[model samples]
Target: MTTLNACFRGQLGDFQLDFEFSIPSRGVTALFGPSGCGKTTLLRCIAGLNFLPEGKLEVDGEIWQNGKQFMPTHKRPIGYVFQEPGLFAHLNVKRNLTYGRRRAGIKSSNDNELHELTGLLGIDHLLERDIHALSGGEKQRVAIARALLMKPRLLLMDEPLSALDQDNKNEILPYLEQLHSHLEIPVIYVTHDRREVERLADHLLLLKEGSIIAKGEIGELLTRPDLPFGRAQDAVTVLDGQVRHYDARYGLSTLQIEGGTLEVPDQLGPTGVYKRLRIASTDVSLSHQEALNTTILNRLPAVIWKILPTDGPSLNILLRIGNMGEGSPLLASVTRKSVEQMALKEGQQVYAQIKGASLLGSSSTTQPRAHCMTPLIACE
Candidate 1:
């Protein structure tokens, strides 16, 4: 598999940022960390905004920087979307969207691409409106359409939804999902929000003060007992499943996964469609044996993989869904007293109980796996 390899050593005043890593060349790669974890700085380095003389970056085969050779910001094929939609205040939405395409020397006859992008972003209706008259969500959609018109090899988004209110953010998330689904170019997204990563990212990279602490697929990273994310209080695991049965009268749908079926509330999509569901660690509970007269609707047999302690008195239990190592794992958080009461240990068989309402389903797409032999290069 092709990969994006990067190595950088720089300084922002007294803070030092030094790291080397490689991620898959396709799909969304989320850079997740706290406020001061250098997520934005690294993104700038990739965009050629914060030029690092010693930085090294290779995207799919082309080298953007190596030793003294550096590509200027304007010459690189990149599209950037910031938190605020920096649309031209004096121009209509149509003019603002076409500005980048014209500057990139694209032919004016490529109206089909423009129409498709505007329709996908749901901004075709706002093309006649002035930029100052649009709402926050509409403005952001226009910005995204403008970025896509450039036909870039790489896309960089820095918290594009952070400035909007919850309602506005919800309005724009589905369009972003659709855009991600149709694009072929790789994207590097920077955010501290775990929900966004779960919703969109194919790969997850956890950053600390200035270095990467862990990196892997979204599903594998979430259930890892040795990682900080697995020990987090709000940790969650995402599973890919297909809709098996839907009862219209009772407003319930059943999804078939690797091990068993999950019954959720009201999945409107077709029965054969693929869907992804997220379950929080706190929303799941484990039982020593299957019990009768339970309110929980979903329960699957699993084997205990490992037990990890949290910051407080809770324990994060990692349970493998099936007998194979490639099967998905489930995470459940319980108090230490419950561990003693149930005698839970590694290799013990148990049932994972989950509430129907707690399983939040979302539309998701898959990508090819990254090969384990992908080269890794480091520089000082």
Candidate 2:
């Protein structure tokens, strides 16, 4: 497998940043952490926007940065889309996108490629409009178009959606997913938003105080007890399954994951539509006895594994799925009172109630995976 590995160590004003990670030569590599966690600073260093003391950046065997022989930002081939859509107010949308076309090293512009990008981003009608006249979402789309139009070897995005509100983020997610599905170019996305990382990153780089804390696929890290951040938020177990059967009339999709069959919302088209479903631990419920008449469609029998105390007024229990293959696990968080009331214990049998619609993602590709399940786990 082609790998893009980077090793660097630098001190930025009292902050010493040291990050070393090797991501697959393709797909999104998400840099995730809390606010003021040096996610952006590291991204800048990689982009040559911020010069580090002793840094090295390599992509698919091409050296972009080293200790003293660092390549200038203008000289290196990188397409950067900043946090705020940094469009030129004086230029129109079309001009902003085509600006990089005239830059050195860019061979030529194909009218068809430009038209396709405009169409894909839903900016064909706004090409003639001024930058200031566009909405935040539109501006971001244009900025992304500009970056892709340059045909850089790698794409860098630093919290591209943070400036926008929730509605705007939703408006742009489909476009971002389309870009990932269609293009083969590698992307390094920096964000504090767990949802964004969960939906987009093929590899997860956990940063804390300007250093890497943990690095792995999204799925593996979510249930991992080693990392504090992965368990901080409501833990969502991502599952990749083929749309075994989609009953359009009933509005449900039967998915096969690992050794079990699951039912989720019928959002996919045909059979080949790979799906990444998120089942939050909170949404899952455990029953000590057999559930014969439960309304929940998914009630797979599970064996109790590790039951631990959560920081909140809850208990996080690790479950070994029955008939879903040995050792493969699922997570459930329930109240301590409920656990004691039911006398939940290890080696006990229980049914895991999973909702069909609780599964999130339009087939999340970048996030973590159990068996490298189509490489969906820690995503962009």
Candidate 3:
């Protein structure tokens, strides 16, 4: 197991990066926040790229920085992927890949690792091509492959997908999923995008301006009403559901959740087990009773837990949903105007309308035990 138990505090010209949280002994721990919210600053501090005023950094049980013991950037065993793919144009793709591949041999078996990575990234055909000739997505895939070639114990990604267009993002996302599913290396992923966090984060550390606002498993954190970042456009409810059955005739998948069945888009699985789904706040509507025949498929029984009035037009409603299986409660999001108009209150029985969904995982749609685990940093 690997853990990060350290605190770093620093003040730049007009910005201050002050935050603390531990990663899991293993798995992806996402640092999520708004733009210019100290996410990248914290990342740089951990990587030894930026020195904090009073900083202490540790990874894999080893102390990398502690006031007097500041490890240089090059001395650390980390792979850094910038927001943009910073590839060297002077070198060919093969040469750039080999640059990091040589370092990986220190921890992995050489002959197979190199061949496997090339195939996984699907850049073997572009090896002979020049760097500038590649598309934004292709360049990024190469950047990721190069970083992995270093065989780092910790991978640090700073909004690696933010710079790409939608098409380019789509092109690279599958590779990220594969990376998350198969790689054993721990990753500290920094992003402002909720979708990326939902798709990849096992553990989550929520950040606000120059401080750690909250930290928890991804699904739980998103459902927290007290969170300042909770009502933004990125705010969403996370659910782990299994595909009990798929009705191909109607192009629907019967997702058996705790409270009841939810029908979502058909791309999911015969996935034998289940799929994790992300439902947006705006996608859901509130009703006094279960919804009747309409284009919407889910009309489950629910209890209103809390209502957060976000603004004049909409509200953020938190619902305590009964899981179809054994587990803790799940959360759903709805708007404020809907809450007031319906006079939704605690313990009131209501029907929730759900629209969009993003299906996750090829196997059991959730954590083996309870969601996930995270590391904690002890600070005085």
Among all candidates shown, the one with the greatest lDDT: 1
Candidate 2 positional error at 55, Å: 2.1
Q: Give the per-residue lDDT digits (tens) of candidate 1, residues 101-176.
A: 7777877675788888999888888888999999899999999888878888888999899999989988888887
Q: How well does candidate 3 match the true structure in TM-score terms? A: 0.84
* lDDT for residue 344 in candidate 3, whole number 0-100: 76
Selected candidate, larger lDDT, 1 vs 3: 1
**Local accuracy by lDDT, each model:** 0.81, 0.76, 0.73
Please report how far candidate 2 places residue 109 from its true position, in Å: 5.8
Q: Which regions in candidate 3 have their CA more than 4 angstroms from the true location?
A: 10-15, 103-111, 233-235, 256-261, 270-274, 291-295, 323-341, 355-375
Using TM-score as the measure, the top candidate is 1
For candidate 3, the clash count comes to 11
Which has the better TM-score: candidate 1, or candidate 3? Answer: 1
Per-residue lDDT tens digits for candidate 2, residues 184-291, read: 677889998888877776677899998888877776666666666334437667666667787878898887766577877655746756666677888789886657
Ranking by TM-score: 1, 2, 3
Full ranking by lDDT:
1, 2, 3
